[model samples]
Target chain A: MAEQVLLLDFWPDPSGVRIRVALREKGVEYEYREEDFQNKSPLLLKMNPVHEQTPVLIHKGKPVSESLIIVQYIDEVWPHKSPLLPTDPYEQANARFWADYIDKKVHYFGRSVWETTGEAQESAKKELIHCFRTLKGELGDKTYFGGDRFGLVDVWLIPFYGWFYTLETFAANFSIAEECPKLVTWAQRCMERESVSKSLPDQHKLYDYILEHETGQNQPHL
Target chain B: MAEQVLLLDFWPDPSGVRIRVALREKGVEYEYREEDFQNKSPLLLKMNPVHEQTPVLIHKGKPVSESLIIVQYIDEVWPHKSPLLPTDPYEQANARFWADYIDKKVHYFGRSVWETTGEAQESAKKELIHCFRTLKGELGDKTYFGGDRFGLVDVWLIPFYGWFYTLETFAANFSIAEECPKLVTWAQRCMERESVSKSLPDQHKLYDYILEHETGQNQPHL
Candidate 1:
């Protein structure tokens, strides 16, 4: 039997980075197939017929779509090394709560910032800062969102920091690190892990990519 | 040791209904404290300081917020009598995917229908119909969303049928069962199950409540 894991991914996409980080954390060897959003791959379409979205993970012969769900599946199937979730149900639920919170709050804040102009952008920035501050407050001396150990929530949130920082720099209005000092520190701490460090693209590179693609578009100023 | 399960709930909320159904299905006797959203309970606030939302489950004193997470925890703790999720990893992932999708799509569509006006309402109705139709398509031949068993997804979605019927009657523009026959049948099938049926409020009563509330408010119709 062949050991296979295929990730349909695109660089700088936080959702794709989630699966990539999970794979690296688990030390799982897998094939990487970067997808073109304009021209999606046949396998990507076939595997994820419902969404036709990227970050589809094909493990062995089975395909799992949705970044968060894929991450959970990976953790379950490969539980020996670097468990994404905690052992206790309460702890696991806590981890999932933050993960879901991040999905609900911060995830869309970034998009709203990117897609809007003027007051909307300002509003999005405010929302982002508020979320970061809340996250920092939630951290409150914990080493990781998972508490004392880097886990799913840590990995899920860390990827977005790169883009967020870039957005702050280019926009030249908001300062995330200055506002939410602890969360910035947390992001840095998360990046210190080899899996996260290796999986993330350079902040400058991501910044340049976003600038190049986003110019002339009525995009939200993040 | 006392086996105490504390549930902070609102009688009319669908999210609260998800946990209630799970509790009933698992045959777990829980102490329910109703929350007036206008004036939330202290326990709800303390338990879920971040979201400060209702349907926070305090199991043996440990708080588990987020209805889906609470349901999953309930299933794990009491796995014998009723299995809310499948034991298989892939199947469980699929169940979670649908549950998450319903949370985003179905719930949001319902909210959009309730909270908007004119063109916005029409757009929201279109979105709602699209989601319901998609769900109906997905349910094609499955006896329930989980297939052969009334599982987590069903529990999460069944409450919305009450709201759906209420919306249909108020708007007088759509029939969910007529538009999405499969989904309508699915709702009926779900209600027939004692666990789910017992947990839901009567359609006419909920509709009357909604009518009374709408009449009391000078809100613009959307």
Candidate 2:
């Protein structure tokens, strides 16, 4: 039986990138369908009727929504491949906690930097910095957010580094390198991975893409 | 060495009940410290400085915050006991997807029926009904959300059923039994477990507690 894997994703999407990198890490080949939010594919809407958002992994007809959940799914199904989560229960808990922090705090707030301006953007920048500061504190002296392994936390975060150029291009004083030097170093280390380097879209291209379309907000219609 | 486990929780907290039930299901003996949220314990403050919320599970000296996460942690650490999650990877993904739905959609919107009023309350009630309807669609005729086993979705949601009385007391016409009758039946099935029945605070007590404290809103204080 052939494995049928398809990822409904949007380019330069942090959540989508997380799934892409996870699949790459596991060496799982899948069809990548980039979603145009204006004209979303029928399959995507059918697969994820709840959110109707991208980064939906359709594995053998069963659709798994939520990017972090998808990453864990990819890892669990391909357990014999590159293991993303730690085997020890305590370490697994820690991995989940950090990955969740990145999702709930960092990624959620990070996008605001490019979407809004003046006070709103400033507040978002401060919050992103605070979030990164906390992450940096937790990630101190470790090669990856998963300690010695490029695991879940690394998967959730490193892709966001793809937006570093776009973030800097938007704000004059904002610099990820200056704010989180260790994280930047870690990002550099992650980029060395074939899975990560290949999966992430070029940062400059992302900057142009966001600027050209102003499709950055990507907030679902309420 | 005897295991040192403690739960920092508040009475009438649905999230806290989840951990309590999981612990009971595993027959794990541990201390339960009911927090005075007005003056939160210094240990709770130190343990979960990020959110400073309840349902923080302290195992040895380490703390695991977030109810669903804690439940999974408990299951992983004590795998031989009554498992809350499925062993099959695909089933685990489905479990996680629904559990996350319960957390993100059901639990997030369920409390709005009481804390809010006017059009906001009406919309919340509508959304809650819609969320339950979606869950019901997924659940169908299953004995539990895990099909037969009392699993992740059951553990995450049954606690909220304890608050069904509170919701009913708040709104004359609000009846979960009317909107989600099958869920009520599932709740009754869940209550048959000593782990569930013993761990949940009395429904009437929960109603009185919510009335007294009016602490229906536990949103993170920023």
Candidate 1 chain B: worst-modelled 10 consecutive residues by lDDT: B213-222
Q: Which runs of model 2 end up more than 4 angstroms from their true locations?
A: A212-222, B212-222
TM-score of each: 0.89, 0.92
Tens digit per residue, CA lDDT, model 2, B82-190: 8889988878888888878888777767677777878888888889889988988888999999888888888888888887887777865788898989989988999
Question: Total backbone clashes of model 1?
Answer: 5
Provide the clashing-pair count of each candidate structure.
Answer: 5, 0
Interface RMS deviation of candidate 2: 0.9
How does each model score on lDDT?
0.82, 0.84
What does candidate 2's lDDT look like per residue over A54-173, in tens digits? 889999999998887888889889988879999988888888888888878887677788888899998989999899899889888988888888899999888788888988889769
What lDDT tens digits, residue by residue, belong to model 1 across residues A1-222? 146888888887888888989998888999999987767878888988878877888887788988889999999988999898998888888888989999889988876776677888888888888888888877889999878878988887988877865668655568887788888889989888888988888888988877677554443222
TM-scores of chain A across candidates: 0.91, 0.91
